[model samples]
Target: MKTIRSRSDRWFDAVNNVLIAAVGLICLLPFLHVLAKSLSNQASVMGNKITFYPIGMHVEAFRFVFAHTRFFEALQVTLLVTVIGTVLSLTITILAAYPLSKPEFKGRKPILLLYVFSMLFYGGIIPGYILMKALGLLDTIWAMIVPLLVVPFNLFVCKTFFEGIPESIEESAKIDGATNFRILWSIVLPLSLPVIATLGIFYAVGYWNNYFHPLIYISSVDLKPLQLFLYETIANTEELLQEQPDSVRLSMAPEGFRAATVISSIVPILLVYPFLQRYFVTGMTLGSVKG
Candidate 1:
């Protein structure tokens, strides 16, 4: 039997499509503007003539940013922290989540409550900074990685996915004389790639974009991440310009410089997304679905 769509159904579909397109454009337009401004000639950028496309196209801003030694150092620091932190965070989250997913585990509920409580009630930045200072993590890369080893929300997402796994699979592994650790390593983890990829990206993106923790804990210029560098670049542009000779400052485009720096900082992680794109939707669905 052929099913006929109702008029109201068609109207609702049209409205939903329009709203989704609108939302996408809202998010996309700002990035387009930044890209256009970055690529545009200094005069066009300064005159605010650049919009979604480059006006009097030029790559001078990109050239200047790439040549900057400080920018490269910050980029290296950010890449290091993001990779190391994401790996550590995922490892810890998996260790904790797997145990909590098992209903037979004693005190699981209490442990879960503690994790949830920490998420809801965190000590403010001052306390966190003081703790980092006391631990001698201040002004170090460890300060960026250690303080955010695990996120409770991500832990719960992994736990939910684990809980959904059929017990029969583990039982079969047990019959084969597999230990708990062996089961987790060889069996459970192999089956949980979707959630792993999802959480990995989540952790990676968080560490990559982190500026607040860096701002508070890291005082050393050498330890600053790309985000802090970008912030300082824009924030100090005017002061830097004032310090420069009038001819040099007049020739430079501060807005274009800032935009190019922003793009460069974000481009690496953005490139990484497409490789993990296939797993993302599946991971979110499986990890979030709770019975």
Candidate 2:
């Protein structure tokens, strides 16, 4: 009977749903554990007593971070870098990718090869450091972003996406007397939102999480980004061993503060993620099939 068949289908769907939910929870459990550990008491954390839920719920860790002298300032620096760096990287990447996407463009192959070559073989860190030093980017915010602006992987993906667009559509736009720039701004971009949003999230997250560049290039305390500041606080365990007065060392649990910093770092990512969630899914399947 048709009714029996419908019931069977519903049961299959329910089973699949349960499987998916179980997998989702499995993947999420680690992050949840970290969050719980971060809010739990330092003593509990030190004793290896905390699990997926807070033990002896405490506010010291969050309080310690909030009271840090450079916390807010570093946060602002990181925000500025994320916003400005994402915009610049997006602009340069699109301009580069769009031209490369057009086969008719002379020497496109060579340019693309050059981009790909860098990915396979990179100049080692010493040379890169020398180049940055020569550029006078040391001790500057530009040091963090300028070096990593155009990622070759993202560039290739964008170029591939653009190439996947039907040439006939572009031809029609051209026939309508729309200039290439105009067409890009008015038409191509609107359709390319999926990839753009995905790339924006990539760039934003990259910029937000970058710390080593600042550590190496920036010596000025005021110029350091939030990640570097947090790293200095949490990752450098030697500080805890220093024979400093108890008054100087706050009672905040190091583990909890680390958690708070991680949480703080993830907030922007979380905020931007919802907007890009649709695009992220769409971009992954951008050209997987042609219809």
Candidate 3:
């Protein structure tokens, strides 16, 4: 037999469910409206004709966007940045974080204080630009890859997590005749998967969405990352349309095509997100729990 709730309890539960659904709709409606607008006729959109649903359907915005040569070139650059940047950042961050995680290692305290100090400040853009220029990294992909070799937040989290791990494991490995480098490589790396995966996703997303770096450092049109290309595509649509009178000008930029580009850029990350999502909570919690 089912037990009935009191009138007040039922009312509260009903209100709570309503609130949850309302919040979900608030989040969901915008994406749907964007999708609808992407498919809607330009005339309908320009006059503010559509509301929660599109007034009329159209698909030309995507066609127009894909027809350009620059989109593909920018896409290739973005892929390179996301893949290579993620790997390089992971390598540097993990290598730096691992040593800092261990306290018994000599000079770890000073090195950590140095990392903490770095988090607070940076040489302004002019000096940074001069250094990069002196190094001949300007307009080169290396400018994007080399500048962000260390991440302070990742280092701290990793350090805290490593501190939580007992020193006895390394001691055991050493007692078994394993060298310092060997124990770190063979045991610590394997045990550190959760944090590594977590940081990998974080760095990957940062690289994928990075635009300012491309704007400041890269001079060649070919070197523009996907976000920069997408920004230019959205921001300069009118000028582009002006240059080619007969070519189509998408009024709403076909919410579909814009959404499609966004979705595409994110899909790679999404594919990897599930695997790491499990580790994310645990990895992130390590710092909080240890502290």
Best by lDDT: 1
Write the residue-wise lDDT of candidate 2 on 139-226 in tens digits.
8889989977999988887888888888898899999999999988988899888789888877887898887788888889888898
TM-score, per-candidate, Cα-based: 0.92, 0.83, 0.83
Query: Runs in model 1 with CA error above 4 Å?
Result: 1-3, 242-248, 278-280
Clashing pairs in 1: none
Q: RMSD in Å for candidate 3, one decimal?
A: 3.9
Which runs in model 3 stand beyond 4 Å of their true positions?
1-24, 245-247, 250-283
Provide C-alpha RMSD values for all models, in order: 2.1, 3.4, 3.9
On the 0 to 100 scale, the lDDT of residue 118 in model 3 is 87
The sequence of per-residue lDDT tens digits that candidate 3 reaches over residues 1-291 is 999889999999999999999999999787666656666777876676666676667766655666752777887898898789889888888777777776677998888789889899988888889999999999988788777766788778777776777788888999999987898789888887777777777787778778877789998998988888877766766676656536455443434456445544545566877777766676657665673
Between prediction 1 and prediction 2, the one with superior lDDT is 1
Residue-by-residue lDDT tens digits, candidate 1, 1-291: 988999999999999999999999999999999998888888998888888999877787777677743889999999999999999999999999999999999999899999999999989888988898899888899999998899999899999999988999999999999999999999999998878988998898889989989998888899999999999988887676567566656766899878888888878878888897876676557677764
Q: Candidate 2 — which pairs collide?
A: none
By lDDT, rank the candidates, best first.
Answer: 1, 2, 3
Error of 3 at 50 (Å): 2.6
Residue 197's C-alpha lDDT in candidate 3? 78
- lDDT against the true structure, per candidate, is 0.88, 0.81, 0.74
Answer with 1 or 3, whichever has the higher TM-score.
1
